[model samples]
Target: MTKPDNPNKTRFGFETRMIHAGAAPEPVTGARQTPIYQNTSYVFHDADHAASLFNLQSFGFIYSRLANPTVAVLEERLASLENGRGATCCASGHAAQILTFFAFMEPGDEFVASNKLYGGSLTQFGKTFKKFDWHAHLVDTDDLAAVRAAITPKCKALFVESLANPGGVVSDLEPLAEIAHQAGLVFIVDNTLATPYLCQPFDWGADLIVHSTTKFLSGNGTSMGGAVIDSGTFDWGQNDKFGGLTAPEPAYHGLTFYETFGDLAFTTLSHMVGLRDLGATMAPMNAFQTLLGIETLSLRMERHCANAQDVAEFLAGHELVAWVSYAGLESDPYHGRAQKYLGGRAGSVFTFGVNGVTGGYEMGMRVVESCELFSHLANVGDARSLILHPASTIHRQLTDEQRDTAGAGPDVVRLSIGLETLDDLLADLDQALHRAAAEGDKAAE
Candidate 1:
């Protein structure tokens, strides 16, 4: 085990922390990597110890469903990556979103959310979330007035994607965070597309940062997982907005989380109550895979960004392409915001129009079909390139106006650039575009 000089002091770089942070050599066998504790239950030293753990007096593994050493390390690793006080791993990104809201909202309480979100998230909020009486007011997050208007007395949180899905639009986070704070709302950002390697939402005033680790964090696309990072900066005890964290609980013998756990209150509460009741815990095996993936996060993201920029540039000037939506491109509408918040390299996932919104939609489908290097699928952030026609697949549930408003126009093609050589990826796209153009000409003839 490599003990840090101090918990409060961070001396190592991000890449170094990705591999060794929250990990220790196995005491018994000197295992260098985090070993998966696949058991369902852990043995307590005695009844006193069990009571101590159950009462939240001390931290120890009680059940695999709530906490596991392997999973804990993954959580800690994620927390380290985000420079957060803590993080909780869950079954999926969708589960993370629900659990996050559960921390602050009761039934009938509402939250404000960005309209430009993953299709799954939009459906989860617009459709499924209503079942819980947890309402969401969706608006264009970029519109400051709309965002301010969305907040009401019942608004408990503000949610948005750090790097929006489909369109790859970068959310202007600082001002939004200020808006959320002025209203006493928890600012939650989905950092799935950007990952911690690209952007740390906490640094920009986000109280909570969420991730779909199934994407870039797993790097190889072998696992499905989600993570919720707590910045440990939000003061739940300040008001009734986060009563679940501030109030004494019937669930845990009237122990208040904010009082008991201090900065780590939200994370502790989510682990003990949210995972226990909701049963959306991430498995030990998946956690291990995600940990492995994060070790190379910095490296893979560099390549992903480089390849995506090249592809975006090529498509911007292509005769068959009408426009590109990558923030890395100088011509992109989001380039300014990207430069201000996301550093110079605007992540790997982006969208482009093959022809025009009308003709492009048809070409988008054919191009997706014709692509050889890029896998035509719904998931993004894999080491292998991926392509998805959101208008037909992910965003099919949304109406035409909704889809277009969210930047998933019928002609838009979302690409998750990978670690493949730039030449190979561009060549694949070139061939696919030519094939799609030929089919279009034949149909026109």
Candidate 2:
């Protein structure tokens, strides 16, 4: 059967491509929507055809463990959006990170990472990876000298978040990517917070981009998914350090990925070997939901950023607020970096400290609990506002010093601004703040 050509020919904008790309009218049924291929296996022409599929000589789905048609469309769409050679979807963002590392790093290898990161990522690198004999050196990535000093001979990658969680620090990907290349290390960027709509890591020299689609990519809170996009720009053949790509694969007929697949080796291996062996494949239904959310990603992000800016400004001057740390604020230390990298929109998530006039941690919790419009949840990047006290929740396992570094303190509250009206959000916050303060005063009296 001849493959149908892509429907839209013109180089449409991101939003346009989101709804049109990877979607074509079904040739067999003439259906307008991309139908879900829910079956676990596809019928082969014969035994020889099945063998060719197993050998990676042909592109056809033999098993859902390796690939699914419904999932493939989403992967292709994400790869196009990211300007990457290809993408591999997984169960969650953490699964994508683990699978990506497993594809490149051998036991006893190390990677350098920024100290400021999502609490889950920090825990994964600092604790979980160690169990596999893979080590991570945490360093202050903002200081070039410090980054250079922390690299060891065994270091294989330099990892950073495009826009860090909680702290809202925007990484200078260009400089960092250059540093990684100079050091003969792969540059891995988590584009979860910024999403591809606001920033494409590959455009700034990133070799690999990872996303927790559960956040902004999904837009709504319906599904949990993740993806890893390979820019195919990194020359794995140039260095002997990465033998996984350059060396012969003992599992698949001694295939040398770099020689056989070239630019697509990383993503191909991620799907064929990483997800195949690890069993971290994303569900076809979830991928479909993610693709649905991605269709309006650009539109939702604009509103999210605008609403967040208004909320940030209001919190910055409020008497009940002790401090506001939003990159959109001119007073923020990360303002310059955010402006340079975040395309003038400082994102929807920011952290602030409620004045202890409400007492300490307990009062802060009350403020979060009292909020009428904002849901108290752990996740971010939802269309609805989310509130969380990370110190008592996500970062509770960390020491005080560690908490400070991760931007989660007893008085600190994190907000994931949604598309709600600015007036409604502010009013809800105001009522919550007053109630928390009154409770604190009663306790003191």
Number of the top candidate by lDDT? 1
lDDT per residue as tens, model 1, 5-103: 224237789999999889989899999989989889989999999999999888788999899999999999999988888999999999999888888
TM-score of decoy 1: 0.97
* lDDT of every predicted structure (CA atoms): 0.89, 0.88
**For candidate 2, what is the lDDT?**
0.88
Whole-model lDDT, candidate 1? Answer: 0.89
- Give lDDT tens digits, candidate 2, residues 305-357: 99999999998889888898899999998888777778888899989888765
> Candidate 2 — which residues are off by over 4 angstroms?
1-10
Q: Point out the worst 10-residue segment of candidate 2 by lDDT.
A: 1-10
Pairs in clash, predicted candidate 1: 1-25, 361-411
**Candidate 2: residue 36 lDDT (0-100):** 85
Give model 2's TM-score versus the native structure.
0.96
